[model samples]
Target: MNNKVITKEAAAELIRDNSTICTVGMTLVSASESILSSIEKRFLDTDSPRNLTLVHAAGQSDRNRGIQHLAHPGLVKRIIGSHWGLAPKWMEMISGNQVEAYCLPQGQMVHLYSAMAAGLPGRLSPVGLNTFIDPRIEGGKMNSCTKENIVEVVKFKDKEYIFYPSIPLDTLIIRGTSADPKGNLTTDEEAMKLEVLPAVLAAKRFGARVIAQVKYLVEGGSLDPKSVVVPGDFIDNIVICDNPERDHRQTSSWYYDPAYCGKIRVSPQQETSKAPLDIRKIIGRRAVDFIKPGAIINLGTGIPNDVIGQIVKEKEMESDVTITVESGIYGGLQSGGIDFGIGRNLSAMISHQDQMLYYNGAGVDITYMGAGELDRNGNVNATRLGSQCTGAGGFIDITQNARHVVFCSTFTTKGLEIELNDGKLNIVKEGHIKKLVNTVNQISYSGKLAVEKSQKMHFVTERAVFEMTDKGIMLIEIAPGIDLEKDILQLMEFKPLISEKLKTMPMNIFTA
Candidate 1:
């Protein structure tokens, strides 16, 4: 076996100028930090590897690490990924017109890697039809600098589908838990084994150099056959890192927790027991009412993340329902902040590809997602609105499949204020922006399609609750102390069908 061990600096030097590189992870979990950090260091020090394209199926890291480390203006020429919400520096580069960005559906990007690994020309699907990813629209272009059309909308038997042509990958950088002397990789202690196999094989199939970073070293054949995920034959080089416990997990705040890696079983733990107080907490309590034991639930990022955590802490139903983040953590203490999309005492960790397949195939029972703006027809904008290009990460894949959906949001945003007095809500001041609009600026969730499929749809807010009815959204519940005509009808852009059995939301959700 050729000597595979290498220094981080040497690994960084392997990347050539103007080569396309592919990465892994979403919102911090399973991201390649050591290599990305080294690459960033190399570029900043010597300005080599300029004009390189970065490819990822999902957002690799937050502002501090992962792909965010390589956000320099000239180092990256283009980026093809599903989400950029976590990479603020890269977003800034796109905002400054110094980098080209293209955002596609997370599922499509993952499948495209599989296609590449299989030596296929490109991946074909109807996932991006009628959405911004279609060529007729922005064509997956996120910034002004991206000139090439990455997606094409083609017709098949009177049906329209999108085709994502695979690009030649020059290098692949991935991080795993261990490697034998021959470079067989294992994810024994990682938070997630996210697309390691696909990314490695995809790069190798295309004659690209594959570099891996590992936490520990092992002698040849010391690693269990089943434990070794990526074969040593394909890995070109390996970099063993010491003290991976320092910066390897999702965030610096957390060391490795056995629960997150599925090494331990999960039991009900009291996260919180207080009644919902904040507006998001109120919405979460309402969403909890929809929860049924043993049902699989996927929580969207940002605010919906809070809703689920508040419910788990307040109700201590950690074991009642199976909770999954889009990044593939399940049954642990779902947290927020920089540690979003991770489970503290998780039941299992999986790859983003498997989760996407489950989502696209309707394996999820229901999804609780955050919405920025919603139209009267129940169309929710989870991604971009107007010039703000908050790329739809897994939003399209999760919503397009799971027929039963509950969208959570405040009745208003920006400067909305309310008073909760004796379990009664009083609107002190309305937000400058109304979340319920006449028409959504973007179609992240199709209420019309949901209605056509007879999917159950519910919208939960601190002030009001609505359900999809044949005649459009029907107001079903309102918070106590809120006037039906003034607070509910006057606030919305259009009138909804008032439910014949209109009732007030539960007081238990408000008072401690």
Candidate 2:
């Protein structure tokens, strides 16, 4: 038998110091946890592979499980990631300027891998234009220590675009569901294909060593040809995790669920548990009213993923309105929070690279997302709010291209209280932190760009709904039993443009 399989420690030894290593995962799905843990242990024991660079598209940690294992100061010198909310330890390191960091759009990061595979100079797109990712702004730099420019501006045919230069990869650490004796990998048991294919291709192009971790190893010819995701010829080492239930979980919350991997289809009734009537439900109820029949929509993580999805299912509009998740899932109920990126009863599952192409090219009809901060210029700060930095995970790509944008958030955060009685809203206590401000700390969604493209933009809260117009945000509707001046205007940091024909939000939305 050809010896292509190795232990996780042996695979960890393949990495060299100061080399660029890229990984593939979304939260906890397909995270290669055994490999990551081994690498961390090897570094701690010998301190051999120090000052390495880590690159990942999605946030690949459940606080301390996945990539957070390498959060030691010398283990990683630089991090090129799309999101940072989950990796709290690395967030602290980046905040303290202990490591240099640069954040890029998640879609563009996947596209970068493809470009690297093709040996292209860079990947060009309009995904980050006019946002903080544009070089004119922060250039996706996270700390004062990061000096190199990874994102650039270029003009093509008199139009502007953001160019992400390809960074040479030295090592690829990826995960899969199974592997054959010859090293061919398959993802039949994984929830998402993620960016493992492009990552391997990129590593092969750069002559980088590829180390893959899988849950199972089978005979060479037993696996079907079409099931192979990465050919054995492209991989250098394969590690079969001994304890998959702990290290190779399907998601952060579950060890393995056949429904997540499309092995078994679940009923819509089982997936759709009605959310209790609350502020989020009210905001979701109001937001869903804007969707037309046959409209394809994208749902983001927070309120949009949970509340709006529940409302859509409760309304039985799954057949009428198509729902797509950024994780390349189509026509399935998306799980919320840490269990995100996996779903049940999925109609189709495509690679994230291809799914991003659809989002960047033709785009969706509308996208309902959550917002962290909103300013007077209509810019949103979903990535960075105060000291909490959650990098834009496809938020920039989705919101920038979508024809219509609706941001669902509470009027304030931290500690706010409200009551719903007899189809009216009463603010018992205002939130300590106001989300609406004069200027957002970071721009995740450019309100000016939305207005420039004539895209419809709406901000829905429990109390009121505001529309982004040519002038600014205009108060178009207010909830019943709410005082316009005390509960609405006084709570905001800036006064908004009140519509001449302001009306009350439909009372039915407040009903159970």
Location of the lowest summed lDDT over 10 successive residues in candidate 2: 266-275
Worst 10-residue lDDT window for candidate 1 reads 267-276
Q: Local error of candidate 1 at 368, Å?
A: 0.7
- Candidate 1 has what TM-score? 0.92
Q: What is the lDDT of residue 343 in candidate 1?
A: 66
CA deviation > 4 Å runs, candidate 1: 242-246, 250-252, 265-276, 309-320, 385-388
Candidate 1 residue-wise lDDT, 122-223, digit = tens: 888867665667788678787777888977878789877788898899998887888887889898877666788988878988899888888788888788
Using lDDT, give the best candidate's number: 2
Against the reference, the lDDT scores of all candidates come to 0.80, 0.89
TM-score of each: 0.92, 0.98
Output the lDDT of residue 495, model 2: 94
- TM-score of structure candidate 2: 0.98
